[model samples]
Structures are given as structure tokens and as C-alpha cells.
Target chain A: EPEVTQTPSHQVTQMGQEVILRCVPISNHLYFYWYRQILGQKVEFLVSFYNNEISEKSEIFDDQFSVERPDGSNFTLKIRSTKLEDSAMYFCASSEEGLGNQPQHFGDGTRLSIL
Target chain B: AQTVTQSQPEMSVQEAETVTLSCTYDTSESDYYLFWYKQPPSRQMILVIRQEAYKQQNATENRFSVNFQKAAKSFSLKISDSQLGDAAMYFCAYSPNSGNTPLVFGKGTRLSVIA
Candidate 1:
């Protein structure tokens, strides 16, 4: 089965620096999403994109966070200024459709660490 | 707002036995979806099973099954004939029927399968 793929499985960035996490969602999937899981914590939703625009976002998704589908399969999450609290495993997901019954497939996740 | 809760922080089961992970959620929406995701040590989020609120029958995938009680707002995952690979962080997630809404996840239950 096709799976969502993320690059730079581990990322270490200095606080206040910009970092971009890249993901290549399954080829035929349309809906895209970003989520984060701090160590030993629940996974938290960040943002969802469809039709080339953000459909919904969580409060955790602040102004410093932005997502873009630069091309057909490349969906990127960019953090303008990283903070220590931003250190977590970031996961990207995609689904063939946004229907409730359709499952969202997730990537292996990118582990981001801020100094 | 929707919130999912996994009361059991951790659980253990012997290989070839069965184990159940508990999950509950608070949701006002009548139409929604529930999911169980397994995150192994590699931190890859793998979809285990899914249930639709409208469906009365529980969903089953191989050794994985769900006991969904809509009235009680409970969705639990049961892994029968457990293997070492079943050891992972199990997350319960919820989402409204709307396509724009993102998934709300619980704190997750860490399952350890002993050989």
C-alpha cells in the first residue's frame, strides 16, 4: 500500500530560526493535514488543507505556523520562529476523500528538536 | 469542541493473549467518526481500525476489532492473539462528519506485549 512519506526524519534547529518540514502525501489523496505529538503526549492537530487552501486549523496552529502545497504531492509545514515547545514529532496525513469513513494515512513523522 | 480520552496510560499483555485498550470521547455531534491508530517505537502512526457513528456493527480488521458504544461515547480497541509487534502507543481519535474538521486525538495508551 502507498504511504505518506516525510523527509529529514530528524531535524534540529536553533530557537527563533525558521524550519520547514516536508511531506509527500500519497499520490491520489486530496486532503492533507499536519499534527504534532510532544514526547509522552497526545497527538495534536495543527492544520488541514484542501482545494489548495486551509480548510480548518487548531488553536495550536498559530500565526507562526503555515502550510502550503507547493505542488501536486509536496505539502510542507513551515515554522517561522521555532520555540523549545515546538520540539516534537510532526506527522503528515492524507486521505482519498474527506468523508468520515475514509481513513487518513499518516507518514512516519519528522522528529523536530529545538535548541 | 470534541475531546477524546484514553484513561489507561499503559497496559500489558502476554503474547498470544488478547488485550483491550479503552477510549472515551465527548462529542455533541450526532454524526461523527472514531479511529484507532497504533504508533510503534518507530513513531509511525498506523491506522488500526475505524468506526462510523451511524453503523451499529463494530468494525474488525484481522486480529483487531473495536467495541463501540455510541450512547456511552466509548470506543475501545481489542487486539486478539497479540504479538510483540502489537506493542505500541494506541491513540483514539474523533472527527465530525464535516470534511473541514481535523481529528481530535486522546492522550494515547501505551501497550506492551510480552513474549
Candidate 2:
């Protein structure tokens, strides 16, 4: 089965710095997403991308968080001016058609550590 | 706003036995999807099973099955013949039926399969 691949399994950054996490979604998938899970916390939705644009985002996806499908294969999440609380495991997921029954496949996740 | 809840933080089952993990969600949307995902030690997210809100019959995949109660907004995962490999953190997730939406996940339940 095809799988979503993410780069840099682990990342470390300083407070108020910028970090970009990159992911290559399944080749045929049309919808992509970025989610984060704080240690010992629930996985929270950050943003969803379709047609090279953001379709929906949660409150946690504020000005600091941005997602871009810069190319057909690469989906990236940029966190500008990261804070200590921004440290978490960031997962990238993709769905074939974004239908109800279609399951979203996820990558191993990029663990971001902000000091 | 939609919220996915996993009441049990941890559960254990003897090898070859059965185990059930509970999940509940609050969503006003009539059309949506629910899923159970397993995150193993490698931190790779794997889709265990999924259920559509419109389907009255629960979905079963191999030894994994779901008990979906649409009226009560409840969805539970039952793993039959649990094995040592079944030990992982299970997350219940929800997403909209249509459009490009990201999944909202519950605080995971950790399952330990004892030998």
C-alpha cells in the first residue's frame, strides 16, 4: 500500500524561531491535513488543504500556523515564531477523495521540540 | 464544534483474549465518519477500522470490529483474539462526510496485550 512520507523524523528549534515540516502525501490523494499532538494529549486538527488552498482550520491553527501545497507532491506546514508550547508530534495525513468512508492515512509524524 | 472522547485511559487483555475500547463523540452533523487508529511503538498511525454514520450495521475488519450507536453518539472498538502485537495507543477520530476536512481525534486509550 502507498504511504505518506514525511521528512526529518525529529526536529529541534529555539523559541521564537521558525520551522517547516514537509510531507509527501500519497500520489493520488487530493486532500491533505496537518495535525499535532502534545505529549500525553489528544491529537488536534490544525489545517486541511485542497486544491492548493486551505479548506478548513481550527482555532489552534492561528496566524502562527500555515500550510502550503507548494507542489503536486509536497505538502508543508510552517510554524512561524514558535513558542515552547508549540513542541509536539506533527502528523501529516491524506485522503483519496475526502469522502465519508475513505480513511485518512498518516505518516510516522515529525516530533518538534521547541526550547 | 465536534469532540471525540475516549473514556478509558488504559486497558489490558491477556493474549488470545478479547478487549473492547470505548469512544464517544459529540457532533450535530448527520453525515460523518468515525474511525479507530492504532499507533504502535514506532509511532506510525495505522487504520484499524472505520464506520460511516449512515450505516446501521457495524464494520468489521479481520479481528477488529466496531459497535457504533449513532443515536447515542457512541463508537467502540472490539479486538478479538488479541495478540502481543495489539499493544498500542488507540485513537478514536471523527470527520465530516463531505468536503476536505481534517480529522478530530480523542485522547488515546493505551491497550496492553499481556502474554
Candidate 3:
């Protein structure tokens, strides 16, 4: 089975530094998403991308966060300025398009640890 | 807003036994999809099972099955013949029936299978 792939499985950065997480979604998938989970907390949606544009985003997806589909298969999330609270597991997911309702296949996730 | 809830924080079952994990969601939309994802110690999010809200017939895959109740907005996972390999953090997720939306996940239940 084809799986989403994320680079830099684990990353440690300073609180004020910038970080970028990358993902390569399944080749035929049309929708991409980013979500984060703080330790022992729920996984929260950050943003959704389709047609090379952001379709929707949650409140947690503030100014510092951005997503891009720079190429056909590569989707990426960039944090302009990281905070200590930003430490969490960041997951990238993809699904074949129609609405936002299809089953999404997820990546292994990048453990972002901010010091 | 839609929200997914998994009331059980932790559960344990002896090897070769059976276990059930409960999940509920609040959504006004009738068409959507529900899923159970497993996060192993390696923190890789793996898709275990999925159910369509409009399908009365539940979904089953190998030892994994789902009891999906559309009226009650409840979707529960049943794992029979559980093994130590089943130990993981299980998250119940809700997604819209359309194509571009992101998945909403519960806080997750940690399942431990004892030998």
C-alpha cells in the first residue's frame, strides 16, 4: 500500500527559530492536511489544502503557520516563529478529493520539540 | 463545529481476549466518514478501520470491526483476539463526506494488551 512520507522524523529547534516540515502525499491524492497533537491531547486540525490553495484552516492555524504544495506531490508546513508550546507531533495527511469527508491516509508524523 | 470524543483514556486486555473502544461525535451533517487510527510506540499513525456514516452495515477488517450507529452519532471499534501488538494509542476520527476537509480526532484511548 502507498503511504504518505514525511521528512525529518524528529526535529529539535530553539523557541524563536523557524522550522519547516515536509510531506509527500500519495501520488493520486488531491487533498492535503496538517494536524498537530500536543502530548496527551487531542489531534487538532491546522489547515487543509486543495487545488494548490488553502481550502480551510482552524483557529489554531494562526499567522505563524503556513502550508504549501510547491509541487505535484510535495506538501509542506512552515512555522515562521516557533514557540515552546509549539512542541508536538505534526502529522501530514492526504485523501482523494471530492469534499473533505474521505478517509485520509496519514504519515508517521514529525516530532517537533522546541527548547 | 464538529467534535469527536473518546471517553476512555486507557484500557487493557489480556492476550487473545477481546476489547472495545467507544467513540461519539457531534455533527449536524448526515454524510461523513469515521475512522480508527492506531499510533504505536514508534508514533506512526496507522489506519485500522473506517466506516461510512450512510452505511448501515458496519465495517470489518480481519480482527478489527466497527459498530457504527448513525442515529446516535456513535462509532465504536471492536478488536477481537487482541495481541500484544495491538498495544497503542487509538484515535477515533470524524471527517465530512465531501473531499477537501480535514479529519477531527478524539483525544485517543491508550490500549495495552497484556501477555
Docking class of 1: medium
lDDT of 2: 0.93
For model 2, how does the per-residue alpha-carbon lDDT over A1-115 read when each residue is reduced to its tens digit?
8999998999999999999999999999998989999999999989888888888888899999888887678999999999999999999999888776788899999999999
Off by over 4 Å in 1: none
- Pairs that clash in candidate 3: A98-B99, A99-B98, A99-B99, A99-B100, A100-B98, A100-B99, A100-B100, A100-B101, A101-B96, A101-B98
TM-scores for chain A, candidates in order? 0.98, 0.97, 0.96
Residue A72 lDDT in model 1?
81
Candidate 3 residues lying further than 4 Å off, grouped into runs, are A98-101
TM-score of chain B of 1: 0.98
Listed per prediction, chain B TM-scores read 0.98, 0.99, 0.98
Interface RMSD measured for model 3: 1.8
Lowest-scoring 10 consecutive residues by lDDT in candidate 2 chain A? A95-104
Q: Write the per-residue lDDT of candidate 2 for residues B41-108, one digit (tens) a residue.
A: 99989999988899999999999999999999999999999999999999999988877777889999
Residue A101 miss distance in model 1 (angstroms): 1.7
Question: What would the per-residue lDDT of candidate 3 be over residues B8-107, giving only the tens digit for each residue?
Answer: 9999999999999999999999888889999999877888988887789999999999989888888999999999999999999988876567888999
Q: Model 3, A1-115: lDDT tens per residue?
A: 9999999999999998999999999999988889999998999999988888898899999999999887777899999999999999999988887464566888999999999
| Worst-scoring 10-residue span by lDDT in model 2 chain B | B95-104
DockQ in order: 0.79, 0.82, 0.72
